[model samples]
Target chain A: MFKIAVEMLMHDKTKFLGLLIGVAFTAFLVTFAMGYFAGFMTRGFALVSENSSAKVWVMDPAVSSAEATINMSDSSLDSVRGVAGVEYATPLYLGDVTARYANGHFQSFQTIGVDDATLSGSPQPANLLHIPNSVIIDSGGTEGKLQTPLSKKDVWSYDGSHLQAPTRELRYGDVMLINSKRVVVAGVSHTIPRFPPRPLLYTTTSNFKRLIAGEKRYITFIMVRPVKNITPKELAKRISQKTHLKAITSDDFKKETVMWFMINSEDVGDMVNMVVLAMLVGFGVTGVMLYMFTYENLKQYAVLKAMGASAKQLGDMIFTQVFISAVVGSGIGIGIASLLAQIISSPTFPFRMMWFAPLIGFFGVIIVSMTAAFISLRPIKNMEPAIVFKL
Target chain B: MSKIIASCKDIIKTFNSGEAEVKALQGITLDVYENELLMLVGPSGCGKTTFVSVLSGLLSFNSGVCKLMGENISAMNDDELTTFRGKNIGFVFQAFNLLPSLSAIENVALPLTVASRKRAEILTLASEMLEAVGLSGKEDVKPSGLSGGEQQKVAIARALVHNPKFIICDEPTSSLDHKSGEIVMELLQKIIKEKGASMIVVTHDNRIYKYADRIVHMEDGKIIKVAS
Candidate 1:
């Protein structure tokens, strides 16, 4: 019976293609839309990487996934340093720093100042972060970076004019512009580099203390890293009580970043709408095409019945055919969609797809195909074998 | 002679539509013996097809008891009747109505699939039956690709694959030319003898009548003559 169903689909490659392409496109749209949703939810807290090494992040007392970032007591830094198993503690002042672009325009930025330490500074700027002019930006961060180090004398110009920047074989002396406070490309790291406020810039704690025009000098976020004996959560709880501040470990901080992203904007809704539309298109086209297929095969069903085939057997045949279509179509569809998602991973859409979405899509298309098969079943389920005998 | 496999004892069938009524069969009595090849001939609108349908448990008469394999046809419910028909009876249609989507072998295996037994066994049996019907190596070919004679052979193969006790054929070769019709008739006669299954065929083609062991002639739903 399965062989027969396979033969039926194989005999009409054009019809199967139509069904497959239709289903594949629908799946692509749904998965790509999911990528956007995931991207949006994670972007809001790009600070997770920035504040990562800080095992204990001490935030404002009113801190939550849905609240505005506030100031922490400057005195809380020493108390955190004295905490048990406390190797390094820093009064990480995260603030909005506006960079005057070459075009004489200032863009708001997320800036942080960490006391020059080894094990407990931000991962994005652990080394040379204390330098006067050095920073890390996503390869695809501002201008969407290329992850390879390209060598051309013309590539490393005075200004940001290198199509393929000679990011290698250059020292802080050759790459740095200490006069204008610029951290030139001394090394090109091939990673999903972190950026703050959609773009990033790094400078020394001294420069940050002097450059931040505000007189209050109260830190926005306090950071600490656990030594050999201390756990991150315990440190955070101690900070929370001592400073009357909200404390989150790196893991909790990551969740907060994701949570803030999810509930803070309409981006999630857009992604949801996109998936809803894909499913809608999937179901709609599946209904029309599968219905036509059912209509085309109705006479064949009648003939089978006339030959002593039972109604249940006939139904199973129809279901088997549709089920095969669904499996093949959805499999090809998801495979193509995954390849596409990988090809388009950039600043425009940042997402790490879970196994769940594709798995769900696979099962989802099968159910949809079954429903589509059943949608066209009005004639088949109610097929009258007596008619063929009449003729 | 063996006992009757099917007996239509004074079967009566009527059709009533609102204010008008039509009687297709009245007071028809016949006993179909085991392994007998019976040809029922009648003009259009005669009760030849209806009688075969009732005997196959595919139809029910308005009055009278039609016993098939000793089970009263009228007394069985729809599911029970279907079961009895599927297990004990086979049919060959005039149109050679094989499912276009299924290959010749798959069509032949359909009855066993409907009975929901082991599928691989049914496929093997269906292949052998098709081979017996003179359609060797055409098992994987769909009905559309088959010749008229080949399609008819597939229908016959489907009928006999289930190993039924009785085969009900409605104009088995009505659509075929004289040569093709004779081939189909010969196959049916050969299977009836070998399988010990009785058959009642309805056809106007007398060129193939030599294959019938008994011929029952009718016109306007009334039996005019019976010859052996």
Candidate 2:
């Protein structure tokens, strides 16, 4: 009977293909949207992820996430250093600065100023103390918007048109101006990409102040390492109580950052809407197609019923057909999505494939197919076997 | 006396249309004997089909007893009746009702498959039955590939594949030409004689009445006469 069901379903190639495509399209869109969402959430806390050695972060009470911050007075850093269970504390500066390339092209960059002595918040190769007035650029940006023009001639054509330049990546000894102050690219650091992609510059706190005019002498966050015997959670509690500021463990801070973005960002809402719409379309198309397929084959089902096929047998046959469609359609859809993810993934585009993406797609397709089968079961259940004589 | 293969006594069946009640079968009583080809001939809407459906347990009756192979069909639940039918009753329909997706042998194998017979045994039996119906080389051909006569032969093969005690054929020759109809009746008669099984054929075609061992005439949902 199951074999018969499969043969009947496959006999009409066009309808079978249509059903598969509907399911596959749904799976692909749902998976892609979910992967994009997961990617954004991961990149949301990239700053905290990079400075993993910092157990606790101290910021102003109004600061909700690492992306958005309020400046804290220099006394806060000193006060954090003096607190018990705090092994050492370093002041970190986070602000936006505009960099002018040699061709006079200006681009905005997010600047991170680690401590001059310890380089606490820097990415790998924290030897910034060896180089003076030099900054490290993120590798992601060096290949992207931060690439340097070879010469002024490359900025314009012979007709005086504003033609784009054929540029090269920023490398060591590349010079750029920040607030009229000259800075050399000391090294390129490979770091996780940020949410709203921006060129990154890592410099010492003193250099940051010189590069940005009229910048007050304040820090964005205090990165603290808890003493060996004390947990970061306990240390954060002590620091928060002592300074009357918001001090949280790095993990908690990452979750808080993601939550804040989920609530405040329209991008997340838009992605969620896309996922929901995809699921609805999947349900509607699959349901209608299965219903039509079953309706057209009701005569055959009646014949089987009159031939002494039990109701349970008929139900199993329908379920077998739906299960096959769901499993195969999901496989094809997720396979295509994985291939697309591989082809288009980049630092600028947030598309990370979490394990749950495929899982959600597979189970989501199953639910849709099963629901369709259930809906199609009604006519078969109410069918009179004696209709075989009439037809 | 020949063994009584099936019996129907004082059976009543009705249908409820909007604002009207249609009595399709009213007080139909008949007995089917082994090794006999019984034909129920009547005009359209005369309830011959309804009577056979009730006797075969494919339908329910409002009152009275219908038994097949000495088991009370009306006393059985739906599942029990279905199993009983699968094991004891065979059917050949006017349309030949072969699942278009399946080949000739597969269609012939349906009854045994419904009985959950072993796969190898089912194939062997289905193959033998198809060969017996003179569809030997056409085993793999779907119904669409066969002529009307060949398709009915396949339907007949399917009906007898499980060796049921009784066969119920409803207008088995209505869709065929006159020659094909004669051939189908001859095949059905030969097969029933060979197996010594009882049969109840409901048909309106008077041309094939000569093949029945006993003909039961029906009119207005009642059996009016029995002739041999």
Candidate 3:
């Protein structure tokens, strides 16, 4: 009977292919959407990830996320270091700045400043200190909007109007202007791309103050390392109590950042909508196709019933058909999604196939297949075996 | 006296159409004996098909005492009836009712499979039955590849594969030509004689009347005459 079920489903090549393709498409769409969402959330809290050595973060009470920060006064860093459980503490500065290329092409960038002595959160501390007036730019920024024109001929005209053409990739020794001061690109740092993708520049706290000029309260956060005996959560609690400021472990900070984006960003909402729509489409197409397949072969089922096949045998046959479709379809779909993810993902377009992406797709296919089987079973369950004589 | 293989007494089946009640079988009472070929001849819309369905336990009646192989089928639960039917009854249909996806041997093996026989034994028995039905070299051939006569032979092979005590055939020759119908009836008569099994064949075709040991005529929902 199980053999009969397989033969019946496979014998109709056209319908079998249609059902497989439908399930595959659903799995692919759901997996890709979920991977994209996971990648986006990961990058949303990239700052917390980069400073993984720091166990606790101290910030102004109102600052909820790393991307949107309120600057703390200079006294905050000293105050955090004074806490009993804090072993080491360093200041971090974050601000947005516009840089003008040598050819006068301007682009906005997110500037990050680590403590001058420790360079606590700098992606490339050695490179920052290797050159004078230097900053390390993220690799993604170098490939995208921050690419510098090769020469005046690349962008300039006599009338001061520029025609943009072939630009050179930003690399070592490239010069850009921040606040009317010259800053050299000392090195390229490969960092996780941020949401809303702004170019990144990393420098020392002293260099940042010198370049931007006249910002009295510049420290955005104070990164702290807890003592060997103290956990980060315990240290954070002590700091928050002692300083009257917001203090959280790095993991908690990352979570807070992701929550902020989930609440505030439309992109997350849009991705969730896409996932739901994919599931619905998967359910609709697979359900209709399975129901139609069963309906067309109803005479065969009636024949089996009249031939003394029990209701349980008939149910097993239907389930066998659905199980094959789901397993094979999900396999093909996840395979395609993995290939597509590899081909399309880049620093600029973030996509990571987290372990759960395939899990989501597989369970999603199962749910769709089971629902289809249930719908197709209704007609078979109620069909009278005597109808075989009539047909 | 030949053993009574099946008996039906005061069987009544009805259907609901909109607000009206349609009587499909009205008080059908009959006995089928071993080693006999019983044919139910009737016009269209008569109760022959419905009567056989009740006797085979493929259907339920509004009221009746239907027994097959000495068990009261109307009193049995669905599971018990299904098990009883699988073990005791065989069927051949007007349309042949062969599953198009399976080959000749698989179709013949369906009864044994339903009986939960071992796979090795099932294949050997199904192969032997197909060969006995004159489909020896065509065991792997699907029904679509076979002619009407050959398909009917396969259906007959399937009907006897499990050695059921009784066989129910619904218009088994209606879809075949004159020569094919003669061949089918001859084959059925020969097989029933060899196996010593009783059979109830429902048909409107008069061409196969010579093959029956007993002929029962029905009209409008009742048996009007029985000739033996």
Candidate 4:
């Protein structure tokens, strides 16, 4: 029966291709929308994802996601560090600053302040922290606004000695003004793109205070590591009791951030709308094409029915075709989507093809295809096998 | 008991099209006995096709006693009728009605496939039947790839492949040339006689009338004459 279904579909090359294309386009839209949404989710939790070593995060209760910058008293770090199950606690300073590059291009950046002694939360190695006025930049910014300028070939020159050489590019010793204070690029960090779509800059806590004045002690978050015997949830509970601040485990914090972004960000709403629109388009095309295909092959169905094929057998044949179309279309659609994701993938683009996203989309396509197949089966159900003689 | 494979007495079937009642088969009384080839000849819209449709258990008559192999067909539900039809009867159509997607052997093997026969055995049987119908080398060709005559031969093979007790061909040679028509009729007759199966062939081709064991002529939804 499945063989018959395939042969019937293949008998008319034009109709067969039309069905495939319809299903494929629907699959592509659904999968790509899911991938794009997943990408936004990844960026929304970039801070939490990057600091995966931290067991718990202590923040101002009002601060939700990486996009929300709520400053807490710097002394809150010591309170977390003093908890009985706490192994270590470090303050992470997050602030925004504008920097004018050597090309005189000024852009806003997410400046991260690392613990001076341990260089925790810093993109640079501990050894690189010794260089006074040193800073680390994200590679995502170097391609343009958010990428590291040190890696640009036309900008920097390699001198034979340790002394600074004449170069147009930002390098190990080049100075840039952040709030009238000069800072040097000592190292570079490669980081995934973030929600703000801004380049990342890392500096010591002292540098952060100097760059953004008006406060001597400001901490955005306290990254904590718990003792071996203590689970993150237990340690977070203790920290919250001691410091009167929100101390959430990594997983909870990730969920909190993603949820906050989903609720607060207008772009997220737009993205969700786009995903729904894509699904509607795919559903429309697939449903219409399958209905037309079944109607065109109604005579063939009549012949089968007249030849004593039971309703269940005929229904099974229709379902088999729909299932095959879904599987084939999803494979092709996912393949095309992955290719497109790869082609347009960049710091500025939000397209993340997660493994589970395509799996979910596959199921969605199956449901849509099956619904269409059922709609097409209605005419066959009512058809009297006697009509075969009329033809 | 007489060797009656199928019998219908005073069957009534009507079609209500847009408020106008049309009698397609008005009190049709007929019988097809075992091992006999019954040819029905009639002009267009004279109820020849409708009569066979009812006989094959496809169309339900409003009132009548229709029986096949000692079973009351009209009393059976749709599912039972379907099972009985699959096991006891076969059909061939005027247009060959070969599923355009399937090859010659696949079309011939459909009834057995529906019967849930083993694939290897059904294929072998289908091939043998196709060869018997003068389509030896054309087993793999689709209906579109075959000539009008070869397609009809595949249809004939399909009808006889299930080894049913009864076969019905509705104008099997209507679309073929005289030579092809004769070839089809001869094959049908030889196969029916060899298998000892009853056949009801509805056709208007006068050239093949001699091949029938008996001829029934119909007009305006009723049989008017019978010749043997």
Q: Say which candidate scores most in DockQ.
A: 3
> Candidate 2 on A213-326: residue-level lDDT in tens?
575656999999999999999999999999998899999999899888878888767767877887788767876777788888998988787777888888998999888988
Output the lDDT of residue A245, model 3: 88
After the best TM-score superposition of candidate 3, give how far the Cα of residue A214 lies from its true spot, in angstroms. Answer: 6.5
Cα-based lDDT at residue B214, candidate 2: 95
After superposing candidate 2 on the true structure, give the runs of residues whose Cα lies further than 4 Å from its correct spot: A51-64, A70-90, A96-110, A118-193, A197-201, A209-219, A222-256, B1-3, B9-12, B16-23, B61-65, B218-226
Report the poorest 10 consecutive residues by lDDT, candidate 1 chain B.
B51-60
Listed in order, each prediction's TM-score against the native is: 0.73, 0.81, 0.87, 0.85
* Alpha-carbon DockQ of candidate 2: 0.56
Candidate 4 deviant stretches above 4 angstroms: A6-18, A97-109, A125-190, A199-201, A215-217, A228-234, A339-348, B19-21, B224-228
lDDT (0 to 1) per candidate: 0.69, 0.86, 0.87, 0.84
Write the residue-wise lDDT of candidate 4 on A204-323 in tens digits: 888888889997558999999999999999999989998899999989998888898789999888888888988998888888888788888888888887777898998898888888
lDDT of 1 at B77: 71
Q: Give i-RMS (Å) per prediction.
A: 2.8, 1.2, 1.1, 1.0
lDDT string, candidate 3, B77-190, tens digits: 877887888888889999999998899999999988877799999999999999888899999999999999999999999999989889999999999999999989999999
Better of 1 and 4 by lDDT: 4
- What is the fnat of candidate 1? 0.30
